[model samples]
Target chain A: MEHSSTVAGNPVHDNHGGTKEIWRTFWILLGLTIVELVLGYIMIGVESTGGRLGLKGAIIILMLAKAFYIVAYFMHLKGEIRNLVMTILVPLSLLLWAIIAFLYEGHSYRNNRNTYDAYTRERSNIQSTDKKADEKGMHEKKRTGAETME
Target chain B: METTTAGLDTKWWNGGKSPFNVEYGKLMMWYFLMSDSFTFGAFLIAYGTVRFSSNGWPDPNAVFKSYPGASETTNAPLVFVSIMTFILIVSSVTMVLAVHAGHERNKKKVATNLIWTIIGGLAFLGCQAWEWNHLHHEGAWWGSNPFANSDGTESTDNFTNFFFTITGFHGFHVLSGVVINIVMLVMTLLGTFEKKGHYLMIEKAGLYWHFVDLVWVFVFTCFYLL
Candidate 1:
């Protein structure tokens, strides 16, 4: 019994030759990574002092770009069998959304703590200042009583 | 004689080929890799959430760098990891070349490319081991930061927790890939792949080798550079 298929007729397998696009994808991935590193340094190190957009945004954007390359090329989900790509992506998208929701909640919780601290500080300051003013008035009254008696 | 006799009569076993009509063995490997991709994706997503929650998190460079002198403040900027990333990408190129060699039925060239890949894999693992060993902490408690509140309290950021876990897991995968390549190289030397009458094993191994490199690209971005 022969273990191998003859070279002439194997209908199940196709010899899809390499295309220019494959090399193009490789170079693009490499170039994009370099761009990502440069942007990361600039955003995190240089612009840390003063920037409306911070390192977080830069990180997220670069990550998404790299993820796009991986999913498109390495994973071959880009030129996949039609249903396969959707099956992979839909669940992944849901996962991303869940992560986003959790992140937002964490941010909200931190912000809430900051707000609470500020409110408490302001309230304490007002109470302390008011008490000091009342003590000053009482001291003046005691002094005036002594002066009037003398 | 017994093994050869046993090999003679099975209708289901087509040497190494699949009996299942649904998919070829190569395609099955692809499916397994896809499932593994989802596992890695979950790790990355969790990593993202931790990073997002940590307000004003230290840069990877700042966190990983070792200051030579007390006055020296600037941290090393992921230089080691960048080199490691380049090495991995080059190995991926070599892996694809090996697959190309396999398709051409040039066993010597396939062996050479696979050796290069194995070398690159080992080099990557060595760098990771060094990086792991170099990690040092100032505080008695591992998570404590130098910057403390007026009450001398530090917020538990848990950055290092994710750092070790994610990178450790990825490192394990890399190690496994290296072992797999070593096995493939041995099989090539033994002419197992040749007698098996298929170059598809090389193709599958190449796919896996490439996937390992691909995963590192993201890990390098998420864990080191970004």
Candidate 2:
């Protein structure tokens, strides 16, 4: 396929070697994917919700490594010139940076929303039910001859 | 060897015989695919941001559960999708075989491998359709997020929207790749590339087919595994 850069009789680029290389990558990808799934199941079974964030990070790292192999070998980008490689990599890195920024901003918003929800729920409960409960406590105190607390 | 003891091969680098050290068609295809990658990347990144933002984001394990002919309440994560992934990967292997056949100028092998790839691609598309129907029955759609799934899990338009959009976009790519494979297969049978003295056309189509497979790996990780 890449006849311009690839020699006609190169071992790995020629007949059996080419197919063998393809199968090898396929196995590696399949194995990595299976490992990812098994780890997910184990974490779920162990009830390790406390370390879920760590597990998520590990999973993502594995995903990135897999992505690299697929692109480098399956796409045949590994043997390309440095310039062509940079042309693809630089933009991808920039994309990653943009995504990271968005993720950070989004997480912050969710945190704020959760905090707001807690505060609002607290205030609403106090208004609707805590008011009557407070009066009942004051009346009991009056009958028992105890001083009313502020 | 194209490279020499003189330190470098300046002949191809000069863009005289082969500019960019790759054929014009192949180079253009790579360029197209690079841009296409950014498009898909952008969609997945957007999905990630929205997912991480939501406190009640639906779990992929729960959301994507269920295989064909299975009840809706089944809890197996990635079972169906794993099969889909396997199919796409097998199609990619067949495409590689086709390119190998081209290298050997075995027109029969090339045509046969291509037909196999086409069958694989079509099977994958059918799988996607089946999966989508199951999802649609469970209340996932183009715009509306159905809250009626059995578990009473909290869902929003964000996750479901991305689910439909990203996979639909990828399904569209599969459709296009299948069409392209059919074209390449026809040309192989007609011996068009043979007359041109090279089966590089098959190799070029193979690149696109492989790329479609590569993108599915990411989609499977993000949408199914994670």
Candidate 3:
């Protein structure tokens, strides 16, 4: 509907050859997508269950492969300028690295909280025992297994 | 007989082919789509990272659902999305045919294919509407400030926030696709593209339609399948 026949900006092409090549590219993309779906499902499923396949690693690999195919074939990035691909990939890589860092930090924070809770409980128990002995109005020595053995 | 030249002509990339045809709008659209893909890709990647980091994320079969009226259990599975996937794929096929007809200079076939494509787009939108309402009514929203349930109970956890935002964005795109298809259909009826003897508009629109389908495939994998 927006056609203009000025031919000022028209890309000259041997339409027959170009069309055939593009069609072939389409078929190849379709085939790759099907393969990806099948393999990706098996990989993700096995990984989700903590199986031998190292699910997370496998998923990351397959996901990258899928992204590569889509960008190269469907998005025509394969034939595009080098700078264009870098423009897309650099930020993506940085974002992924940031996510990994944040996740690890969060995990460590949870672990620290657990450790603190354990130590606090141990100290409270010792204090409570000492207080109970003091309430009896006797100089009750601390129950030491080593003293008993001696 | 024709005379032969002693020398050959040389040109830039695509070898003297059109350098970014403005009228075709193909190159411009490609650039736009590349940027758009990055946007969606970032969302999906962030989702993956969050899901990976989180402890005890819900399983797809256990979480996302088909309605009880449609299925037999609380875990109705991704059957609704599966149907929507098929509809979108079918629409893509019709769109391809429309583009083909445009190349062939077949106006009647172009119109028919456009109509079919529009119908498919509308069907997808309807399905999305249903899925969204179903999810909302099922308390899929983020809970209270402490992220607790309204009744002082613990609800499903916070990863659902990412789920709703990403998928909701995609659904909004689908809604717009429907509107765009309607506009294209109306333009077709007005004979705007009829005299061109080529369905350039359909070709451009197919790029868009296919991109949407392509994005969904990734979303399906990232959100539901994984």
Candidate 4:
């Protein structure tokens, strides 16, 4: 079977290689995932919030790297025309602001709740005290009733 | 090899050809995937917002400890989920191979790879179903969280709410991808692309499958790992 080099007068680059690059990418992705899993295991032992945040930062970086590999190589976006790449990426940059704003708002919400919402503050305090009594089983039953009010 | 003077001129937007140099269908597929990423981004970001606002959250390690056929008291963490993650990654590899085979115009290889990809999708979904059932049995649902926070305080239902919603959405995507692959496989057997002289359809389907895998990478990191 013969095929044309262009579809609808648009040139399609013929960059096909036998499974070499595919296997290479597969290995890279697998290795990255293993590293992530190892880090997650280590995180179980880390108690400090700062330390856990740092490890989580590392995991997020690894996750982005994996995403880059999949989109660039597996999806073949890297081999595409520059115009196409830019169009897709430029719009996605908007997510940066969205993430920052939303998380900031959430933090402020938590702060507000802790400050002004006496009912929630009291409830949480009571729950923690109940936890100290080793009455978790009993508290669990009572919490079901509490949840209905909310 | 046939480059017209206009093609050499770098006037990509001059009106006659695709500026991206890709066919209309594939270009549209790229844009579609781009928009789909935003939808997923909104969901994960929403999840993060809720997590940030909550006073306490459940530890994923404690909740997702048990695996299939393990005793009820098993304490394994990140084990079964790691298996699910690998299944997705391997399926994504097969999808890449299938796309490559389509480029080579090899019918049998494409069919074989697609079948492997489908099996991988189903396996991942099966693992998810079992996990959900186990969690449900433990009194976790949209509005109920039986697991306490890592600090031993009561946790809000948002944890399980986002968990089930995001993962369920992702699982739905996988199911649809599997259905699409089955359709592509049948079309390949019938020599539809062979008659059409191009396997561009397979390439588009491959893009969707990889997108599903990509989304899982984020979901797994957000919910399971961190």
Candidate 5:
């Protein structure tokens, strides 16, 4: 029986598309990042909720594209056998459910807060207060007894 | 029975071989990275949940508008972060080159690329440190947020809390990756792999380095852009 190491040593398994492929992946990743940045920049002036969400969605898609190139080319996952690829990726699909569930729950929580949590709603509506003053007041309260000891 | 047994024997998972056609170490590294991805996924998803639950959040453009040597009044956003993102991408490219050199058994190329990758990692860390320092001066920390919501309404500390925690975690990963690369470079210089007849260790390190870069892509999109 041949050892697994011997099987892994087969030169047939070592064809990982060489340096040209690496450079190509580099360019693709760089391009995707540039697109994402441009989309993000354009999103700044987008006022409508739908418009802003659309740009954010585009940026997210570009970000995922960048991730795909990095994983496929740089990490050499694309060169792996089909079984290996499936094993790594199939489990990752669970993240879709996790994301959807969490975001839904969070959205519901926000709705509940807005309706029932008067303090939260009131606080959120207030104009921005001087946070430094709040921090100073908290510090002052903490220092009341310490000053006498010092 | 003979035909069925023959088919089974020819399968990659026949008792004598690795079904993945990869050595145990590399396969384990892939599994480790998969698990690590979930960890980062959880952090980012939790961040998303918090943002969703909030009524309003700080505009990333307003918060991340400063860069090194820029005037305090300069109103550029996403500029410094874009540079940081490029540094990471370039470092990831160098890491691929290092791994490719490892494949060719070209020790000199491996060492040089590793050095470049290390430099890129450090430069990225330096940028993060500067950004963190700048934010710290403005009173953003784990439990404090000085910035207001985009609508000029009061904002919650969860903004800075998640930002510091997630990015801090990602920075820690980059720091470890640099250390791992330095170790690989030292081993290469010592001809450790030359004696062992393989640079598989460098390939593993490269996987880890690239994983750090991969996490940054999501982090940049989530915190800075969205």
Candidate 6:
């Protein structure tokens, strides 16, 4: 990210107070983004499912932190009145609740779908075998032997 | 304005006026933004659900890996997206600077910062357009994702659908934000706010711009990082 600093070695703060804070946030956000990229890149190399899951969790945590910084700093919500802050934050938690519920629901469907597919495949296999047996002159001795024995 | 003798006994739910000093326009902006946030939040949640249900997802790194002057085979993940992220973050910086300038009544600095922000917004949109086009030719389309389907079929996986919808919605917001910034720039140059002796307009616009950036933060996480 580009910072309007006077020098690379100088402190981020300039004579202007607010401008300094903005640049500091700019750098922090940039660094976090880079860390996210690095973690994501490393996950590409993780072959184990458990390792990949752990990395995904870590990435999500980092992402949430970055989100907090962006909203609090960039959007200036940190300095807002407590009432205004709660007005936005209180209802937002419902969104997180919705997300978890839907994910669980979707996972349930995934499990059901596997069994459904297997059942359909088994039924089709049995039908095809029956069709082949009927196509041939095969009933073993069922038809004639039953009638003669009777 | 009618003087209300009703005193503090007035019902808290009375809609006559805002009890707090927050302006009507600013308050309305918040309400509108909350609704917008809800929409984006739902889109993201939908994505997460699908992501959870699927056994394997296309790695965002492998899918969105492109950089300026990068080789055709270069697989560095998120290089282009990082640039996009920086563009947005810088734009937010410029936006806040513009707002600060407005507060100080520094017309020159306000105009300068606003122009820089407008430039950033335009550049970000251009990058998105290029990315969409590039991905389109690479077998990623609104209907299908090349990575999502094993047989390279179209219209099967929901990945491309969510991807296109979410990003397209965000791109629309960016495009509108650029337009709004341009108008504000022109108005500033024309001394509209100067004649009025206040630049509250710029501050409000800055709020919307910042909100747009906030939404991008989530989108970046969902689409690029996660």
Restricting to chain A, the TM-score for each candidate equals 0.56, 0.63, 0.48, 0.77, 0.79, 0.67
Alpha-carbon DockQ of candidate 6: 0.16
Q: What are the per-residue Cα lDDT tens digits for candidate 3 across B54-83?
A: 333445544555753664234445556666
The true-versus-predicted C-alpha distance at residue B153 of model 3, in Å, is 13
Question: Roughly what TM-score does model 4 have, to 2 decimal places?
Answer: 0.90
Choose 4 or 5, whichever is better by TM-score. 5
Stretch of 10 with least lDDT, candidate 1 chain B: B144-153
Q: Using Cα atoms with residue i matched to residue i, what is each candidate's TM-score against the true structure? A: 0.70, 0.80, 0.65, 0.90, 0.92, 0.79
Off by over 4 Å in 3: A1-150, B1-17, B21-24, B71-76, B142-157
Ordered from best to worst DockQ, the candidate numbers read: 5, 4, 6, 2, 1, 3
lDDT of 5 by residue, B44-65 (tens): 9999999999999999998898
Model 6 regions lying over 4 Å from their true place: A1-17, A119-150, B1-19, B68-71, B148-155
Candidate 5 DockQ vs. native:
0.49
Chain B TM-score list for all models? 0.78, 0.90, 0.82, 0.95, 0.97, 0.88
Q: Please list the residue runs of candidate 5 whose C-alpha ends up more than 4 Å from where it truly belongs after superposition.
A: A1-6, A131-150, B5-10
CAPRI-wise, candidate 2 is: incorrect
Q: What is the DockQ of each candidate?
A: 0.08, 0.15, 0.04, 0.44, 0.49, 0.16
What residue pairs are clashing in model 6? none
Residue-wise lDDT of candidate 2 within B101-216, one digit each (tens)? 88888899999999999999999999999998766655456665543222233345776788889999999999999999999999999999889778888877888888898788
RMSD of model 4 against the true structure: 4.5
lDDT, candidate 5, at A12: 30
Which run of 10 residues does model 5 chain B get worst, by summed lDDT?
Answer: B2-11
User: Between prediction 3 and prediction 6, which has the larger TM-score?
Assistant: 6
Model 4 ranges with Cα > 4 A deviation: A1-12, A128-150, B1-10
CA shift at A7, candidate 4, in angstroms? 5.2
